[model samples]
Target chain A: MENVRVIARMDIKGPNLVKGIHLEGLRVLGKPEDFARYYYENGADELFYQDVVASLYERNSLHDIVSRTAKDSFIPLTVGGGIRSIDDIREVLRAGADKVCINTAAIRNPEFIRDAANKFGSSTIVVAIEAIRQPDGKYMAFVDNGREHTGVEVISWARRVEELGAGEIVITSVDREGTGKGYDIALTRSIARAVGVPVIAHGGPGKKEHFTDVLLEGKADAIAVASMIHYDLIAQQQSDMENRSEGNVSFLKSGRSSFGEIAPAGLIAIKQYLKESNIPCRN
Target chain B: MSGKKIAIIDYKLGNLFSVRQACVYLGYDAVVTSEKDEVMKADFAILPGVGAFGDAMNNLEKLDLISPIKDYIRAGRPFMGVCLGLQLLFTESDEFGSHKGLNLIEGTVKKFPPKKTNDEVLKVPQIEWNNIWERADRRWESTPLGSCRSGDYMYFVHSFFVQPQSPDVVLSVTTYGETTYCSSVLQGNLFACQFHPEKSGHHGVGIYKNWLTNYSNNK
Candidate 1:
């Protein structure tokens, strides 16, 4: 059985890691590097860093963060959000990212996917699509972090990217993003079933069953989570452990936490539970 | 490891930086270069490439690295070819169209035929971490994947696999659906695999370490 990749998606706003519902009302958690390190040290299979403002500002600001993580962590790193050109892709790859995820740039110029794939390789070029369900029950692909609709249906765009030479498709449901609700399995499955390349399900998954469901039933090759792990850890810490009395809820069980910051047991637990459900994982 | 210089051939076609970074982490003086002198001067040369075989061949020719790479391998110094690097080492490849390769290895690169198993179609460009087993005839014990158990999962992302003229050169094999093809091959100092060790987690770095230990220029 092929192993399902579990990736930690850290949305970066400048240097801070942030998350929001439906890509609005951003809240800063901490530095991108710290959160990246936390996920890397834990059982996360990969780290995906996307600059929330990259598309809006039209510039990539995650180079330093990608370089640091690439040099330090052994897991594969994917940097996305503002990549607009072949030179930008080269810059990120040379800086040490294993892959680059392109959304707006690729949608603007479909041939860019072929050019980048020809220059670098399809395996390193991932086409990211943000899909929001329409009132007619169809999924339309959105770009610029779900701010604008592209009018192209999600499934067709996924197939087009693969035909244009994208190695993978990362589909994020705009409706379920950062909502702590389960993933939009139908939308993910439709794209996954249509495209031949590996599909990464994102923008949902608040619980372990969500991972199993999307992977097994939805048939996604990987799952990218932000709020599920990041916010869950923050919520668990602040609500349950912060105000507890002595001899309770200490963060040093692993003795590896620095500055009282430690990766929660959530990811590992999800991995274990997934494996128990017969899904193979590296962890 | 510190003194041994491992030059990763950067033909502007693949993830050259990550390959070099893997070597640097193991304390190897790993450098990515296209200069003939730098490639010839290195203790070991790693040819890492991805994408089409014809495009890669064109890049090698454009960069004037063809002679130096062929000469490096002819000299019998330890050399390794990654994915498209491995494909480009064959006699020729039938990808997209007929294209000649470096012809160091006696094989032809081929695209995986559409395969199916248990009513589910297997996808091309098998992009995942799947198990690859070492062949018993020539144990990979002397190779980079030596410590890799029978079913050690390595990161693979490719649509084609090599079809060696002689199975004796094959170091390992992997199965995809109902098809089984050559995954990794070793002919003397020239070692090549279809997978990316740089993306294969810890065992991947360990493979790089093992390869460094097998070579002796630094010592």
Candidate 2:
């Protein structure tokens, strides 16, 4: 379908892939390269890398990771985090990322969005909005890892970003992150309704159902998910055992004591079964 | 005419490399330049960018190449603008506030209105690949763009649009959200596209090839 685009997000907090709750506390899950390959092989349309490190790090390791993945994977990739200048954006793009997502830098200097878009073309510039629920039940934008709040409303910012030449806006819900509950459908729908540009909804997607819900109900053009897939709690399950392994055999004629075991013996039986069934089973 | 050069105006904004790369892929020797002499001396010129209308106009003015560019186009040299370059041809743009454009074309740039709840919720900066409808004019029909049918999909990425004072200038149209917008327009030797043909892959390359072929032959 023309409107369906799936993006897999890899949130990093050092060298490890991390999942967090409401964009605050994070838990390391596994290596990012493994997860990136898994997503790439499993029908992900695009991939995104966001380094959650402090701005003082002076270096972003995500660029190398994205570059390495792009070399092997045939899909578009985007990198975001600590992108404060045009030079930073250029560095990431040069490293083989198809697009660069800017947030705090864009808010601090609105003109930067226009400049980057002009230099790289709108297709390569993405505006990421971290939205948190406010006291009055309205969603407010947060910058700098969701530490500082901006009075700018989510929908308004989405509109402004597009006007400034941002080709796409990735709206992430800080409140629903890592909860495995589901995406904030209302927020995603509102932002999707606000802009004529494509909107990518991120955060709080726990299962395949959540993805369907957001795309069908929330009207999000694309949905970015990380946690559930990283933990292996969700994915398609396949069975490889055949009828030959259903029974056990007892050898009592040669031995004084009866010995029993699962019928299909050794690696040969398993390999033959797998080969005949044409199921992908790895050890 | 066989060895004519095409200059792509690069003012520290716009995808100069991609434009140059596209030209190279189409078997044309194109250079990205901000120099007036080079731009004016070229057989054809291309003004390509993806930014706010106001900032682009400012850069053109700052470089002191505006008058020279106008003179070159007036001399009947083929000129084309992509995205913001297309918007730059308008008289004014209402981004952040009302800002003046190059006034090369009689038109105004305005943002897409906010989508109401009951509406289909058209996103701003209408993006994605959409169909392009060709103009009925035989002159436009004779160019490489003439090969495109009424519903050929080209890539688009913009929120604001230009409304030409004269309908005779419009060469193509595209639909977005709830509105049907102008996608391309041409007047004399000048042509502007709201979509990025350079990034549109094969179709984009075809457009560039057609332009180069036509420009070289006409010269």
Candidate 3:
């Protein structure tokens, strides 16, 4: 199977990166730059820097933050929030963001998706759809940091966004946000099946297993997370294992090399013995 | 003389940066404009869209660009249409009660048929890296369009597809379930692709290169 891309989401409020339930009143975590570096160093494929409060603040200060983080990190960065016009899109791209995500603006205008995609190319324009599953078994799109309900169907919007030349769609489920009860796999699979573009599943995901589930079952191209990595549950375990191991350790245990050893003398002896006997040993 | 200027038609619809970035990557001067004079003056023109075919057509009409665009294409200048751009070239689309398109090509755009089993849904918009088949005789087999070999995955994201009246115009074909849809079409100097070359990554870049170096250079 192809390696699934992992994206770390840093939903920022003011200067601090935060994560919370849905979009109402976020819980501050750490500095955006620090979290960005952490994710980049620890095998994250990309980083999403969303200024969650930009709509409320009525300005895009996230560009400065994204610029700072982009300068420091090597991985791809996507910046979203308060991106209302072509100029705003240009500002974020010029600020070193690899891609610019538009949620509320794209939903409000719909045409902005195509305009941005045409100007920047679809690959650089990401449309973030913050959706929630209605009680009537329909997924509806939300805007204004998932505060305002658009009443537009999520699956239809996914198709529309892709048609508008959005290179990717980032679907975040409000009901599943920060719940750590695994992703809304049904919602993700539906969205993934709906559009031709890559779908980045956001919200839920409490553990690495959740990531695997979304990638394998949900068939998501990319998984975006906040609470899982932010709290250091996943990273801490991997770090602990690394710290406990000595030099040149291998995790594979099935006839493979064991951890905390450069090489077992028995394996070396077997290699030498095979060489002396003119027997080929695959290295 | 050294650099080429590519104008992407801006109809106040989709974002135009993706194409501009692609042009920049190819080391060309690319601009997005809806102005007739600017478009007519460009060395190459790219019409890209992502919305209802009727809405895009309406915008093009409102901008008073229909004649200018037809003139540019008729002048034998290089032009390429992407996704909705490709759909717009068709005669009409079944989206939102049958809307007339730009009618540059003889074709119709229609949605994928519904899935058979209620439990097993057929994936619409056909989003993923699907393989595109090139025509035999090594015609487009050697061009930028050739980059998408059989089984070579190109990104796709759309429900509707172009059904060209003439087989000669069908440049490439991609399979989705039981249907082998038109992945791209080439008619004279005009080229259109259902798949997004900009989002297709290195393969997409190769396509742009071929368009610039081969197709665009020939003119």
Candidate 4:
């Protein structure tokens, strides 16, 4: 078994870091670089920056943000959003991302995944699958942050992406995203079982147990968190506002944690819980 | 970490930025360049990249860095290789149909078997933080891994691993799904690893610092 990775995922919308429930109703958080620096300092295994509104605009604006974050953070940074062609991927990578995750372009042309894997290495390519569980007991893939539904089955898509040369797959549940309900175990397990590549469970994770549950029960190799960790940062930012020197952290002072019941915990606390639960994690 | 002309060889592959960042963080002024003269003139050189072996070899050849890199190592100055850079030092690779490498180390880079001994399908590219343990005969006190504990975890993302012809040169090994392979090697001034020291967090950065310090002391 692989050591479980705790990745801090930041959903970016233009200049501010945003979050939403079920991938809708965007709410501003703060500057992504600020959160990125905090996460790296707190022991995040990896960092993911997703441009929430990039696909609609056909241009990724996270280049400046990614470059700024890369200047300080030493961990692997994955940038995803509006990536259409080889040039787009190259530009994002040259800016500082170690890996580029694609969804909209990959769904439009599946061969783009293959082309990317061949041009770069398979390890540099990650395919993000946005899935919504249907009433028929099936999961359907979605694009553009679950706004557009592609009729493609999530399980088959996961297998195809792996076969197409995706080194890793991040399966985000559109229904559970930002809801704090926990990860879709059935959805993540099915995808993890269907593919030979490492699968990262994303979307809902309200508590530390949710992480362990996804890794053990869902069979996920890693877990990507946005609301869970972001809320923790918000709490920290609020208490330390007096010492702050730069950036508008008023958004973080909102004291808004949509993740109900379970309190927000830092990366170290989460890793400590995983370690106590006998799940290997890099602290 | 002071005034050491560290050349981070750039062949249009991998994340040279993070490697340079890690070096700079350690207070060493490193340059990312493809020029042979710059690389040769550097006190220490690091070959770091992530991509196909064939393409990397082609790129190195195109940029005329193959000889300079080999000459730098031959001159006995400190040298390091990361990920594909480590693979490139081997004799050849089975990735994308058997491509010849720099042949500095006598080894063949081969992919992990599809199935483990338990008959379970093993995931390729093993993208995770796996623990690396020093060999029983090897003492890490003198190597770049001097600061690393025996079971310290390191970031890894690769499908293929190196099988050095001489086991004595193997410094560490990591087991993934029952497939144990050489993870790092130390042969005189040449040290390389399959894991990325730059992206491996604090412990990873510590390895670079140790390597630089070791080079400085020896000089």
Model 3 stretches astray by more than 4 angstroms:
A1-48, A55-58, A64-79, A82-181, A184-200, A204-208, A215-222, A225-283, B114-119, B123-127, B137-139, B216-219
TM-score, each model? 0.91, 0.64, 0.63, 0.94
Report the lDDT tens digits of candidate 2 across residue range A49-101: 88887343646777667666655554457888888888888888767676889
Individual DockQ of the candidates? 0.63, 0.15, 0.06, 0.68
Q: Say which candidate scores most in TM-score.
A: 4
Clashing pairs in 1: none
Candidate 1 achieves a global lDDT of: 0.83
Alpha carbon lDDT at A191, candidate 2: 88
Over A1-283, each residue of candidate 3 has an lDDT whose tens digit, in order, gives 3223457788888888886776775766668888787666555556889888887667988766776665545445788888899998888876777688889988889998888876766667889988888889989999887788998999999999888888788999888887777789999999988876678999876655666677668878777867756655324434565788754434322213211111212222322433354432211
True contacts kept of each: 0.58, 0.27, 0.04, 0.68
- What docking grade does candidate 3 earn? incorrect
DockQ of 1: 0.63
lDDT of 2 at A192: 83
Q: lDDT tens digits, residues B1-219, model 1?
A: 568888899887777888888898988898888898999999989999887788789889999999999888988899998888888889998898899999998889887775465666566777777778877777777677877887887788899889999988888898775778888888988988898888777788888888888786334
lDDT of 4 by residue, A171-283 (tens): 99999998888999999999988999989999888888898889888999899988878888887767787476567766655555444654699999999999999998887
| A266 Cα displacement, candidate 4 (Å) | 1.6
- In angstroms, the error of model 2 at A207 is 8.0
Please give, for every candidate in the order listed, the TM-score of chain B alone compared with the true chain B. Answer: 0.95, 0.93, 0.93, 0.98
